[model samples]
Target: MRVWPLLPCLSALFSAPVSAEADDASGITVTAPRLERSLEREPAALTRLEGRALAPARSGRNLGEVLEAVPGIAVTNRHNFAQGVRLSSRGFGARSAFGIRGLRLHLDGLPLTLPDGQSQVDTVDLDSVVATEVRRGPASVPYGNAAGGVVDLRTAEGFTGPDGARLALQGGSHGLRKAHLRVADADEAGAWHLAAGDLSQTGHRDQSRVDKRLARFSTTRLLAGGRELRIIAGAMDTPFAEDPGGLTRAQWEADRGAADPDAVTLDAGQRADQQDAGVIWRDPASLPGEIRARLFASRRDFEQQLPFVFPGAENRVGYQRAFHGLRLAYGDDRRWGGVPVTALVGLDADRQADDRVRFVVDEQRRVQEQTVDERQTATAAGLFARAGFGLGAASEVTLGLRLDRLRLAVDDRHAGSVDDSGSRTFTEPSGGLGITRQWGEQTLYANATTAFESPTFVELADPDGGGGMNPDLEPQRAVNREVGARGPLGDAARWELALYSVRVRNELIPFERAGRDFYENAGSTRREGVEAGLDWAPAAGWSLRAALTAADYRFVDFEDREGNDYGGNELPGLARWRGELVARRDLGPGGLALAARYQGRRFADNANEVRVGPRTVADLRAHWRRGGWRLFAAVENVADVDYPANIRVNNDAGYYFEPAPGRALRVGLAIPLR
Candidate 1:
């Protein structure tokens, strides 16, 4: 084990007294107010990594891998082929497992989770992500049904420029390699823009690999006075690998710390393809008021294959989901009865369907047996309203509310009958209130919110073959209380701190019976945590960033139907503390950056029966930029450390877990023409 000095590197990078104006060439914008808006609207705590922060580190094929330094977030590398990244908000479920129990994910203002409340966000392309907005606690309500928080991803908007293209290639450790190409064009009239790209990677792990391609086109037209219409269409194809499951403590020690076990060689594969199109109309009728309406549709096909050791035991399953929705919104920044107010209101609707099939693999590498097929459909509609008012010269208050109705139905294909086909309507209500006071450059705020999440069709399905749904299951509800502050330290430094507590009732927890897993609502639980972050550009060509988050979670009066008391047990998948530190400086022409990250030890089981060891990883990145061309490279897991980001333990069998990638290097170059 080795420990490195943290101060020398930071001080050396920022010893020079550099003015903020001189760093404008790096594309780091100082929009304090815009940044504050993100903080105020987000529930818990957040960090924005964009512009140069992403450009040099965009070596990996997955966005999750590139963002591992963000506090309280971890990336679960399922294999070289399939990478499932999980975000731990303080100490919550990983991998979106708990149905976003304490977190929510949104892409381009649309919910990616299925109608069943189950969401697997494995398809987003990092190249297309322009910004990511994170909210830590259950404070996020605009998107609906999220008790944790929300992560909103904004994709790149088309540019109005001449035709241009970019090409990037990278190579790294563990047979890691990558290539990327992007092309874009804007019509002379600036009314149309088109962008397309393809990205692929050969992973460091034995079974890990990835291939993805994407395309997007958008156009805008000027309508009658002060009105414009825009349309966008996009598509993506991605395929990745899934390696064998993780091992238990006994197996790990027996194998002398090696990941290889029976050599049974069970390889999993996944293919995801999607297409989306949307249209938007905007009218700016007044200097301070605007109206916008949008309609969108998307179709996604997801397939997974589990090829096991036993002959004919291979299973190929897939699901198809289609979504369509419309939204109308009005916003105004004006004075209402001598009080300044910012108001917004909107309506939204969504329809989704899921189909799954299980197939067997034969000796001839063909699919032979077909076992089960199931289909489910869900529909939901909602209305949202938000208002912010200035209480005085330095104080402000905000209020928000949302109402939703959801219905679900399931049908079995093989039985030739609608085994569990029933529609139940649920009206979910959510609201939040916040008050902010400004002192000099810092803003102090406190808020409370109420949020609800309805059970998905999968969660409500009867495991006993009752041919009926569970009408007794109630929606999970949460009350979040938070207080925080944000401000600038001089002109070149920024910092934020937030403390939050969440109390949840009727939380859904997974239970195992007869080798099968099902969901049940536990009693009550509570989580409290503090999240703090800092960013400083203390000198020219240098930057220092760090974040630390700690959480305490426990079941409060929690029990199952069997009268098992889970109270006093640490919440599953919750880590008590996590943090990261980075120091980067310009090395004249070609620059070099170094980062050190530490992940605290955590429990692998909900019962807090097993503990995973802590890990420290160091990374180095170097790059050069000239004109429209840039070359970059990075080394991850420099010490070749081995660890598991997620683990699932079963007493009789062993551990089924996801491992992190070993030491690997990636090098690539980007060329842009304008």
Candidate 2:
């Protein structure tokens, strides 16, 4: 398939590196800089897994699985291909189904969630990611609301070499198979660059399959007068299996582990397709100050089959979202009256729409139940300012403030459905203050911040009476405080420790009412915890890393209308303690490596009713390099253990979702054409 091409104007912008610093010809220094530099300057409270650490240890399916070892992070795998990971810090508890509360997800600076604040992250394939930056605590103010934290993903810009191509094909147990390929080139002028690739995999579980294809093209141009322009275009198509229900423990034991409890036969399929394009401009000479502007647009369409037993009861749910956003930022660094100060200001606006539909298969596929022909719109406008000052020879203080305005409107029309329309406007104010003290190679820091999250459409939609909607729900809010220290130990080791607490109000809860789950607001709760991690390179070719996170969370002063004191219960899906350990040893000459990893057991539901057992898995990887050619092979799940990564709560009818494949192997190769 032909994907959208990068815009010629943008392709010309990134051809050469542009100085990110501002000019001071006007006797005033403007420290304008690139977004990349801004991110690097910020302190990262969370652990980062990069390079070899990411390649061999990334087992399961999604980005969440790869990050499970991070301190205070838990991943719930609903299926081998679908996963939900949550991150908690110090005493703060994150939603089990979605990782961290007040967490922000970004793709190249663009938010990845629906305007309603819910992320449709299943579309993200791990193989295409270049890097993931995790920011812990409420210090993520610059990204807008939910600054509770942020995960930012960037794709490969393009191959810098003359030309290159790589292809990988493999088959394993459970009818599993996959193929991946990449091709890239840079024009002779070195001003034009292009890259494209595809990834396809047929899964291992019964009736579980996946076929995905993706292509990305980026170009850069060096403009005259010390400016640059860049453009990027990409598209992705993914079709995968879906298992929505779980089995009971009784049935699980009776089945003798031979039958897949999370199995089902359905008539419809599930899929998601997306196309995106973006442009960026950096003008280092405009007004003697560094200035950067970015704009992007993306269209995503998604569909899923309704889980039902009747032959013709299965329905299709789908939506199309178009998102557009723009950002303008300025920064400056200069000494005033013998004191150094750096400041930045930025503004952004984003808009999105959701369209829903249903389908039927009678001899031929056709539109049947238009159960929800709804159009929802959400717009967010925000302004952020941050200033950092040198407190002394070895200490610095940073202060940041952000103001956001969010507006949402929903219009729904289903057959005999109540045609209800409602709109709400919310103004969220959040900020953070931090102090960092550096001594030799050690850095100690303390910070405090506030964050908030608005309710989603799914939370507001009433499942009763033909799926009515709630109009009076309030947004969830949180205040987070944390203190930590990080530094290098000796020449080849690093360690970090953090303690945190969060108080949340108007928490959203899904209640079981008449066999269907509905949404409501829980009174209030408090969460506190500690997280610590260490990475050590004991030898030139060996590395070891470990992390531990523990949290204590409870409902406080919470009362229902009936005055029921349902407090002090362990919040659902909240793990009291979670940890991971990994060790890697490099084998010289052939680029070979051996790896082992272990993770603790985790609860399956918020009520803490069920628990998935702990897991210890091993992996081996070997790579060969000859000139510009490289070949690699990997063996995963060395123990071949069967464990559940996630469980469905509403599946009271007896269905259980098993983990993933066991003892799988793969190999691939890459070659550069010059």
Q: What is the TM-score of each candidate against the true structure?
A: 0.85, 0.84
Tell me the tens digit of each residue's lDDT in model 1 across 322-438: 877777878777898999887778777778887867677543446777755767778878788877787655567888888888877766675634455566677788888877665
Residue 178 alpha-carbon offset, candidate 1, angstroms: 2.4
Number of the top-ranking candidate, with lDDT as the measure: 1
Model 1 lDDT, residue 33, Cα: 14
Report model 1's TM-score to 2 decimal places.
0.85
CA RMSD per model (angstroms) = 6.9, 9.4
lDDT of 2 by residue, 12-76 (tens): 33232333331211121111212232322333365655555566423224665456357765545
C-alpha positional error of residue 578 in candidate 1 after TM-score superposition, expressed in Å: 0.6
